[model samples]
Target: MRPTVHDIAAAAGVSLATVDRVLNQRPGVRRITREKVETAIREIGYVRDVAAANLAKGRTYPLVFILPASDNSFMHGLHAEIREAMIRSPSERTSIRTVEVAAFDPAALVTALEKLADERPAGIALVATDAPEVVAAVDRLVADGIPVVTLVSDLTGSRRHHYAGVDNIAAGRTAARLLGRFLGDAKGEVAVLAGSMLVRDHRERLEGFAALMAQEFPKLSILPVLEGRDDPELAHMLVADVLSKHERVIGVYSLGAGNRGLVRALKARASSRPLTVVAHELTVHTRAALIDGTIDAILNQNAGHEVRSAIRVLKAKADGLAVIDAQERIRLDIFLKDNLP
Candidate 1:
């Protein structure tokens, strides 16, 4: 049988109230008394019943998530996930709030973080752009004992506690291998479209794609990366410009969002040319495009899974509990026309 708090208190020669105070880190306990209670806890192998403790304390985890205000399908999906969480929040004792800021704006994100810090939420989650100011802001939040989890995109060398997202570098390598195999030894240019280099995910994807292309598909040349800021109109204009300049473009890879614009450009330029198109995310537009042969392959990250994982981590941290690492892993989902889910 597991040892109870009364058993630990008796063993430590301390009162039940003292044991409770020491275990919960509450005030009015001497350092020596705390050390004695801790030693007794370890000796008796006392594990706090987290659910019972939470019930007794009536704890409600307050969390904030910051997302980009881009009109892209990926951001929309993320927002939908947050809405779903909000729906289920009441029963879970979790209070979650979302803040949207301009995409790729580090100053605005920092300001949002500062505002969240002022409010003193128990935890924060954000889709981070790689910026020193944003990293510092997150570090400050951490220093103040608030758990910060990076969602979708990560900030390197930051004090963020956890990252709930797929491995973008591996996703890019997979895309490259798929594209290379689909275009069997075809010596043509592949047009690349990205959201922004400031985002670590996009930059990592570009690196992985370039590395694979140099190593395996030396016959194919990757054109200069077109930055669309994850905007559909900008992506369409960039694809059109690239197609007009390079008639030998046999493939296109969109490492970020904006598949709506990609599909538009592809349908407009379909002149008996078998171009292999690969993109990220499985949105309504991308799904339709895949079925109609506008897109050949899609490398996707489940937005719902990412958001859920972020919330779970935040709640666990707020309760000062260890999370199940395996359960919190975000996986990359590959989709094709035949296997669309």
Candidate 2:
């Protein structure tokens, strides 16, 4: 049986109130009494159940989710999942809120983080813009004893307590393998679409995808990445221009959001030529694109699962408890035209 405060009190020959004060670091306990309680705790090995105690006391964790205010299907879906979590906040003993910043703007993200550092919520989850300043801000929050989790897009070098996102580099490498195999020894220029190089996830995906392509599929040359800024209209314009200019392009890798733009562009320039397409995120746009033969494959990570994992990890970190690493790992999901789900 696990030792409790009662056991510690009994071992220390002290009252329950004195043990509670020592455990919670509350005042009014003398130095010697605190030392005796500490000695008893060390001897009995009493482990406090933070969650259970918080529940017993009706403690509410105030958590904030920081997201980019982008007009894309995936971002919309992620926001929706956060809202659903908020709906269940009362039962979960949490107070959840969201803060939207400009997409791909490091200064705005830094400002938001600075403001949050002042408020000092119980925990924070953010879709990080991977800039140096943003990393510094996250480090400051961690130094201030605030537990932070990166959601969807992670800042790897920062002192974030956890990442509630998929292995993006692996996802990119998988996309390359799938795209290369789908094309099957065909030699042509491949067009890649991305949101921005500012975010760590996009940069890592592009890096992994490019590395694998160069190593395994040397025949298919990748064109310069088109930064569509995750804007549907911008993506549409960029893709259409590329298709019109690069006649040798035979494969497309939509490695970021704004697939609707890519889809519209591809459909407008549909031809008999074998142009294989692989994308990220299983959204309404990508689903329809896959069904209509515009997208051949999709690599997805569950937004709902990511949100829940972030919450769990943040809560555990705030309580100074170790989380089960396996339980928090976000798995990648692959969807093809034949296995649409």
Best by TM-score: 2
Put down candidate 1 lDDT per residue, 260-332, tens digits, no spaces.
8888999988875779999999999999999999999999898899989998898888777998999998888
Off by over 4 Å in 2: none
- Report lDDT (Cα) of residue 107, candidate 1: 99
Using all chains and alpha carbons, the TM-scores for the candidates as numbered come to 0.94, 0.97
Model 2 residue 162 lDDT score: 91
Q: What is the lDDT of residue 195 in candidate 1?
A: 95
Summing lDDT over every window of 10 consecutive residues in candidate 1, give the lowest-scoring window: 51-60
- Per-prediction backbone clash count: 0, 0
Q: lDDT by residue for model 2 over 1-341, one digit each (tens)?
A: 99988899899999999999998889999999999999999998888898998899899999999999999999999999999999999998899999999999999999999999999999999999998999999999999999999998999899999999988889889999999999988899999999999998999899999999999999999999999999999999999999999999999999899898999999989874668999999998899889988889999999999999999998888888899999988999999889876
Segments of candidate 1 deviating more than 4 angstroms:
12-18, 25-39
Weakest lDDT window of 10 consecutive positions for candidate 2: 266-275
